[model samples]
Target chain A: MLSKKVILYFILITGGIITLAPFVWMLSASFMYDGHANVYPPRFIPDIFTLTQYEVLFQRLDIGKNFINSLFLSITVTAVSLFFNSMAGFAFAKYRFKGKNKLFNLLLSSMIIPAQVTMLPLFLMLKSVGLINTYMAVIIPGMANIFGIFLIRQYVLSIPDSLIESAKIDGASDFRIYRSIILPLAMPILVTLAIFTFMGTWNDFLWPLIALTDNSMYTMPVALANLMGEHSKDPELMMAGSVVTIIPVIIVFLALQKYYIKGIMMGSVKG
Target chain B: MRIRYSAPYLFLTPALTAIFVFFFIPVIAAFVISFTDFDIYAINNFGTARFIGFDNYKALINDQLFWTSLKNTFYFVIAAGPLSIAISLGAAILLSSKLVRLKPLFRLTYFLPVVTTLVAVAIVWRFIYHPRFGILNYFLEFFGINPIDWLGDPNWAMPAIILMAVWKNFGYNMIIFIAGLQNIPEDLYEAATIDGANGWQKFKKITLPMLAPTTLFISIITMIGFFQLFAEPYVMTQGGPLNSTLSIVQYMYQEGFRWWNMGYSAAIAFVLFLIIFTGTLIQFKLQKSPEA
Candidate 1:
């Protein structure tokens, strides 16, 4: 019985190591010189560390520009999407209107339609509008989404309808009720949605890859993918690029993890 | 009397417009494009465009690459879908047990990968699966096992992708399962125990029956997510090892953007939609039936 307990402990420790080792190696490899990472005896610790890979990335590859681009795009998309989704969600939750439930249901049911189904046509439409290589191409599609609306609607519905009714009796304008009342009460869900939108925009690869043909307009993930295409052999440089792309997202997720996790549970179970 | 109601639609206008333009319109346009020959040349000059009817989809039926992608997608979904659910269910049960201390710590640790950026994780796994110098091979060596070519071998590539996906995704379903488990009445388990049921018997007879709705929900969502396998192959394998890990979305991206076969790509996208939609319908039916 004691031996079995020890064995279980061993398994858990190993499992934890297995789960985390890749990230450890990624950090280690990022600090190594170019050819040092692929050595036969796989060094877990860098013998000699240098910031040259990062220098190469910023100076030669101009990944800093892509970093700024990704940052700008993600922040813009998150802010805009939060504002748009909240307004609609608040309306659905508090207001009585013809076809409101039906419209909401339509949106909810169509969530199963994978985003890829629309990518081709979306690209063409954006191209026709001459917005293909612009950030608008990415931001417009992400401006509002069914999931975001559904999430906010679910949370907002839990707010007593009487609150909105009282506000209306107090002669608050519709927009005023939304801006002042709904926004504050919905702050938690808003932050949660903000995290989701931010992470999603930060990690988005395919649409950006498709939409932004210009190197000048590339997001971090898109740029990293492109960098990998050209610099497949440069493990250290690629690791630095991957680190730059990932760290912001990780920090954001960790910072708002409580709301993020709650959002996931609410979204998944309710969904 | 309901002039007050105009405000809701007014407030809804921006979001509805965005969704209609960006989402619904594009979906309808994709269907239309799938029926036409909208290539790069046609993009340059719409006058040159030809309406190809179902030829693009018919061509897909004959195209070997399309079939390969379809098979690869199915391979991923079939291999990973059940494996993820099982692992999640098991972990949920273990974590929910009174025997487990520090449940939040364990849950957070397990759930960490689910929230991390996929591209970053995929990059890490690429290094971890490095043929010569990976930690995976080092550990396998300790067991006197041969180093497996995780991403490079054609046979192992999809399986490798599936394994990584299961690891990344199981935590999500685990949370749902834990919630489901918590909602199950304690008296049911107590009643089963008093009736002389063993742990396994109690689980099979009581817990499984009670968790049916949650399980159905998880399965359908998992199926939908697994069907859209893109970034894992894109980042880890680039749909390589002779395209063994090429997923439907990856193929669509390549066909549409890489080769400039927009119409043909739309056809592939519709096919993916068809598969996912049918899978969802079947899951709903199964849930409605007496199998529970």
Candidate 2:
């Protein structure tokens, strides 16, 4: 029995180490000098840590601009989508409307259509409207997602109808009820959805790479990919760029992990 | 009275409009564009695009690179999908075990890669797979193995990406599996234990059957996600060393965005959609057949 316990812990700990080693190496390599990361025996610890690579990234490469771009886009998209999705979710949950169930079923079924199928024409559609390479190009596509709406709707459905009815009895306006009652009540799911949206928008690559043509418009992932194109030989510098790109999402995930994990579990619950 | 009726429509208008314009329209437009010859000239002048029925799909049938990417993508999905699911289930079992302590810490560590930006992690793995100076090779030397050029070798590249993908993704399904495991009634396990069942026996009998629905869900989602393999091969190999790591999406991206073969790319995207749709249907059918 004791031996079995030991074996279980051993496997778990070893798995943890293997999982963490690359991140540890990436962090360590980012602090090393150029070519230092390429040395024989592949140092997991920098012999002498310096901030030159980060300095190069921020000062020379001006990745901070891309950082700001990612920040603005992620926050804008998250905030807007949260509002839009919650309103839609509230309607789906509480209100009785003509064709509501059919409309929702249509939306739910269409989730099977991959986003890649829409990318080609979406780009052209945006370009035709002179929105290409703009922040709107990223934000517009992300403004409302079916999954976000579904998540919010699921959460909203659990709220008692008495509260909304009482609010209606008190002469609360429809928008007022949503803002005051539903939004506040749905705070937990909203935070969860917010984290998902923020992390998703921040880490997105292909769409941003396609939509944003100019370097200045690049999100962190797209910027990191661009950096890799020109600086594949410079692992240390690329690692620094990566560290910059990944840190925000990590911080966000770690901070609200309880909600994030719960969100995944909530999402995976078979309809 | 008027406002009462309009409120739901008011609430849904913004989201529904955005979805319709951006998502639904584009999907329909992509299908239409797939039937035409839309390229760089078409981008400049919409009239330059010609209606070419089934030409793009036919051309894809003849294209060597398309077949290579399709093969590579299938290879990745087949290998990585099962591997990741197995690891996820294993990890879920271990973490959910009563014997394991500090489960949250272990869970967090494993899940770190899932939350990190894929492009960043892929780049990090690219360096880690460095032939000579990489820690992977350095560690392998202790086992008396020679250094292999992981990303640079056609034979090794897909496997390398598969390893990284499995590492990156397993934690996600592990969380879901944990949730699924939690939903199983503890009395069934107790009944099995009282029946003189061993650990593996209990698992094979009670756990596997109970977890079937969760397994089905995980498999379908994992397969769908895996079918869209891109950023990893894009950043790590550029589908390199003889295009061994090339994926269908990467091919679509190259053809549509890079080469402006928009019609052909749309066809590729549709093919991917059809593949995922069919794959999902098959999983659903397979899952149902046992019960029937």
Candidate 3:
């Protein structure tokens, strides 16, 4: 019995260490001297811990600009997308539109169509409108995602019809009810959706890679990828760039994990 | 007078309008554009683009690179999908067992990878797989194993990506699997224990059968996500080491954006869509067949 228990602990701890090793290495290597990361035994400890890598990243490489660019894009997209998706979701959940079910089913069925299908034409459309290389290209698509709307609608369904009906009887305007009642009641899922959208937008790479051409306009992942092309030799600097790109999303996920995990359970309820 | 009837529409207008323009319209336009000879010249002069019906699809049949990427993508999905699913189920079962302590810590540590930026982690894994100095090769030497060129070697390139992907993704489905496990009634296990059934037998009969639906859901979603393998290969390898890691989506991106082969790219996207649809349908069919 003791032997069996020992095996389980050994397996779990070993697996856990393997899973976390890269992240630990990323932080450690990011602070190492320029070529020190490329040494024998793959130094887990920094012999000369210096801020030189970050110095080069921020001062010479101007990664701080890319950091701000990613920050701005993620926040703007999250705020706008949450508003648009929730309004539509509330309508879908509470109101009696002429073709609500049909419209929703149409949207749901088309979710299987890969986002790549829209990339070509959307790129052309944005190019034609001179929106290419601008933040608008990312914002336009991010403003309304089907999954976000679906998630919000699913959550709003549980917020009783009676509550909404009473609010209506009290002469609250539709928008007023949505603002005063629905928003507060639906805060849990909203935070969940917000995290999903924020992380998604912040971590987004491909669309921004295509949409924003110049280095100044590039988001962090795109900027990091761009840096990889020019500085493949500088592993420490590249690791620092990665740490900068990844920290914000990790912080967000850590802080609001309850809602995030709850959101997953809600999603799996349908499954 | 008729304000109530219009309010819902009003609420939906902005969102629906955005979806229509940015999503639905673009889908239709991609289909239409797939039938035309759209390239760099077409980008500069839209008027010069001519309708070349089915040419892109025809060209795909003859394109070696297209076939190579399709095979590579399928290889990735087929290999990584099952591997990740197994790992997720194993981790879930172990964490959910009565003997486990500090389950929350295990789960949070496991799930950290899921929320991190893919490009960042991919970059991190790239270094971790570095031939001469990577921790992966470093760890292997303790067991009398030779240092393998993980990313540079064609034979190991896709497998390296697969290993990193499984590590990154298993935590997600592990959460779902844990949820599924919690839902399985404890009475059944107790009842089986009274009947003198062994642990392996209980698992084979009760656990696996009960978790079939969750497994199906996990499998389908995992397969769909895996089919769109781009960023890993893009960042880690750029589909290099003799294109062993070239994925279908990455190939499409190269064709459409890099070379301006919009029609060809659109055709590739549709084929991918068709593959996913059929794959999903097949999963449903397989899941249902057992019950029937």
Docking class of 2: high
Evaluated on chain B only, what is the TM-score of candidate 2? 0.98
Chain A TM-score per model, please list them.
Answer: 0.96, 0.99, 0.97
- Would you estimate the TM-scores of all the predictions? 0.96, 0.99, 0.98
Model 2: lDDT of residue A85: 96
lDDT by residue for model 1 (A120-230), tens: 878878888899999899899999998999899999989987887788888889899899888999999999999989988998878898899999999988888777778
Against the hidden true structure, what lDDT does model 1 obtain? 0.86
Give the per-residue Cα lDDT of candidate 3 at B103.
90
Q: Candidate 3, DockQ to 2 decimals?
A: 0.84
Could you give the interface RMSD of candidate 1 in angstroms?
1.6
* Candidate 3, backbone clash total: 0
**What is the lDDT, from 0 to 100, of the residue A216 in candidate 1?**
90
lDDT by residue for model 1 (B237-281), tens: 989999899999999989998898999999999999999999988
Ordered list by TM-score, greatest first: 2, 3, 1
B-chain TM-score of model 3: 0.97
What residue pairs are clashing in model 3?
none
| Candidate 2 residue spans exceeding 4 A from truth | B1-3
